[model samples]
Target: MIIEKLLFHTFIILAPVLIQTSLLEHHKWSKSPIFTGVLNGLATLTCLAFTYEFAGLYWDFRYVPLIIAMVYGGRKAGLIVLAFMLIGRTIMGGDILFHGLASAVIASLIPYYFSKGFWKMSPVKRVVAAQFIGLWPIAIIFLMLFVFHLPSQFLSELHSITFILQFGLVQVLGIGIAARLNEWMVEKKVMREEIIKSEKLNTLGELAASIAHEVRNPLTVVKGFLQLMKRQSKGEEDEYLAIILSELGRAEEIINDYLNFAKPQFEKVERVHIKEILSEVSILLNAYAVKECFFGEPPGG
Candidate 1:
């Protein structure tokens, strides 16, 4: 009979896990906190409907779903699912109804705390922590059974170590499976985000390289004219023409850097002259004086 009960609970516990994993793979519901909560709540209710009975006492892997909801789904999801489980258990009206409610609360709280640092732990540690938190409710239920002695058969099973061990084993297996599934889902999400970010960067790099190439040709023509103007200018105007030529050269260097995205290995390795670069950059506003004279309406007009 104990073996039969174990087998029954095992199926009940594992079925929801499989369903949850499938939903995670195929649906966008996991991205929304409210939807995730609703999904978990429904799963808990379904598991509760198939409660395992032994020695006139009933229990289910309901808490396993609740724990998963809280730990992976966040506080709002946990609370929402807990409320659903409470309502369902209230309707069920069994000898252990209140005991089950209390156990659910404990189960939810345990994982809530564990989740604060859950991702920091190694995979093995995560599984161990999940199993421990999952089995804690069972221990709580046992204590309630012992202290209340309402079931009458509670005392009979109170000293049965085999019963406790079997239940613990079931909790460990159920919670471990759920935890691993949650970890896998998290890993897949992170990998997907990374891929998306990499694609965006690649697209931006290509766009930048294209824009830089287009701008460089016009800039080169402008620099050639400025150089010719510098050669023709006299003393006072010579200084001004030199500034314009240097500023145009700096602009070309900037465009060249942008183009380097297309062929980074061919980047210029020569040391840049910091003073010359700074002088060109500093005189950029003065270069605008020449630009205004060139493009703006004549001074007399």
Candidate 2:
């Protein structure tokens, strides 16, 4: 735990440098690495103290690492968050000494809940979940802190209320932006896949049309000869000649079905009885029907 806290502090010091180098390479920054690291460390430590001293101030800082790690990295980022949390608590001498640590623990656990449900969420929804999880527990902490002490000269009830509201608004906006970025990436990937698939389908449709045209001419010639043979026969022709022609017609219908499948078609839907359609199909296939479809008990039963 002690080692983890040290690593958390180290991450806070270096995270900006790591982020700027890895993600912000194309973007310009006026800050230097050493300066940025020191500033981030100081600022993070200050916020940790404030959150420890005040009940709900932790709301301002909860999801920073979680969002960064989850978006850019993965579960390892959660460890960074947990490490920072423990370090922040230990530095302030734990919640017991601070009088508000108990509240902070509940407040801090919100992000973990978000992480647990991360896989189930869409990009936009994941951001919303992180935002809500980060801020909702702050209300409980605020109530705990507020009720314990009366407002002093500098801190009034109105001031605390305004701060809470503003804090929440900022959180929502930040998470919203991050979530939008994630969703944009997802949309881009989907569009790329659709374009590739459309190209492949277009090529296939052209090839099928060419093949169908070539086959249809030979099929027609064969049908013509069969018809001539029927007309010239004196004795009763083969009994199955009619069946052969019928099967040929069915084959042509199947080819038509395939052609239609290759080309897109739109249907205008009207309300109709699905059960009635099924019964009609069954009637047409009576000779081939092997089993009856039942809604309930069998007729004999």
Candidate 3:
């Protein structure tokens, strides 16, 4: 009977993984905060529904789902699952229902506080932390029962070292398995996305490089012509050629930015002379000024 119940509880605990994988495959919002809350909420309710009794107190791995919700999904999920547990257990009519709720509240806060950085934790640390949080709630509930001087039968159950060890081990292993499964799911999703993104980037880079090199050939020819013209032309014509050359230089700079992603090499950063940039700006503005009649044959033009 014990083995059968343990197998049943394990099934109930792992049910979410199959549900989540199906949801994700169908592009549903399986990882959404509210959705996680609801998923774990249903799991906790299932746990509460099938609760067993021993040691003169009701037993369920309700905290297993609750802690998973809090650690992986944050406060929103924690609250939702807690609500489900509270409602389900209340309907079940336990002798110490209030103790269950009180211990949940006290233990839940600890995981919620740690949830903010839980995702950043290493996989092993996350599993360990979740197990610790799951078991801590039971300890709190036990202490509460002892402090209140539970009826003789309950106290006697509490004193059974074998039962305490068995129960504690169950909570620890339950949470550890659940946490590791969740982290594995998350990592798989990330790896899949990276593969898709890399493929798209590779296609884009090849297309861009082909266009850039074709475009650069004509730009180079025009630039050479403009430079030669600048050297030979007089006064006003020389100034105009200088402006054209500066504009061509800027166009080449932009083309280079696109070509840098050609897969052979990446973008390079180089110091640009501000004074040269300012000189180009002044030349363009002067040409505009002359064309707008702000100057007729402006100085140096």
RMSD of each: 14.5, 20.2, 16.6
Winner on lDDT (2 vs 3):
3
- Candidate 2 is scored at a TM of 0.49
Worst 10 residues of 3 by lDDT: 153-162
TM-score of each model, paired residue for residue: 0.75, 0.49, 0.72
Output the better candidate (2/3) by TM-score.
3
Candidate 2, residue 141: how far the Cα is off, in Å: 6.0
For model 1, residues 11-63, the per-residue Cα lDDT tens digits are 65555456656755657765566776787788778767877765555666677
**lDDT of model 2 at position 268:** 81
Candidate 3 all-Cα RMSD: 16.6
Q: Backbone collision count in every prediction?
A: 0, 1, 0
Order of candidate numbers by TM-score, starting with the best: 1, 3, 2
Residue-level lDDT tens digits of model 3 in 163-256: 6666677677777888888888878888989999999988887888898889999999999988888788887897788788889999999898
Winner by lDDT:
3
Clashes of 3: 0
Best by TM-score: 1
